[model samples]
Target: MANYINPMEPEIKYNIALLYFNEGRDEDAIKILKECIKLKDNIIKYHRTLGVVYLTNGKHDEGIKEVRTAFKLNENDILTLNNAGCYYAIYTNDLHRAYYNLKKAADGITSNTDEYTKNVIKKNYNDIKLVINKIEKGKPNDSIKVPDLRLLY
Candidate 1:
């Protein structure tokens, strides 16, 4: 007998990983997502999911690196920009870069963006605006946490 593989196998695995992630099975999701990346490293969604998994699982640096890789692969990708913004804002406390990337993503929204994604970008942009306002007022925003960008997926 010959082994058979479906071209959509990676996508299938990616979706399964997503289900696992949403169910709070981070380790299982991570494993499947890593396998998906190994199969199709160019898919930004896989990297994004994996990066979020790493970040939420206390592997901040690794998560940032993976998200950065996705950004490098496609800077104009709304999802990548959103993730980059959230990562910088939340983990690194780099408000400037966060605002820039988030603003870019919000402004770059086109017809290709689904209504849900457009809404997510808008909400994130508004959230960042509030943060910027608070920062400008010398108000401590240490209590404000970045919204999970993964939820937009």
Candidate 2:
């Protein structure tokens, strides 16, 4: 028989990856997400998902590269902005970029944004701001840790 394929298979794989991620199976999620990306390379969500999996698995560079590619593909995506902000803050320790991206995500929220999502974005924005304030005040003893919110997706 000839090879059979479903056009919706990529989405199925993406959903499966998400399920694995929620179960804390980062490795399995990474595998499925990679397959999904291979089948649908143009989809930003696939890249973003894979990036998040990599980051959570401690593959920092790979995660940043994937997320950066997604950002390049669609800078206006709030998820991309949030992921970039979290990645920069936690992994690269680039506070400026993290703040900028998180602020952009927060500012991008609109009427279409659900209340829960709006709260999450605002909370993250405020948390980053607090960290920035402490840093600026030369509070070297204060260490701020940004939460990895990617899994909440």
Q: Score every model by TM-score.
A: 0.84, 0.85
Deviation from native of the Cα of residue 104 in model 1, angstroms: 1.0
Cα RMSD, model 2: 3.6
Q: Report the C-alpha lDDT of model 2 over 43-126, residue by residue, as the tens digit.
A: 999998888788878898998899888989899878788888888788778888989998999999999988887887788778
Q: How well is each residue in 70-109 modelled by candidate 1, as lDDT tens digits?
A: 8878888887788788888888889889899899989889
Q: Please identify model 2 stretches exceeding 4 Å from their true place.
A: 1-8, 139-153
- Kindly state the number of residue pairs that clash in model 2: 0
lDDT of 2 at 129: 87
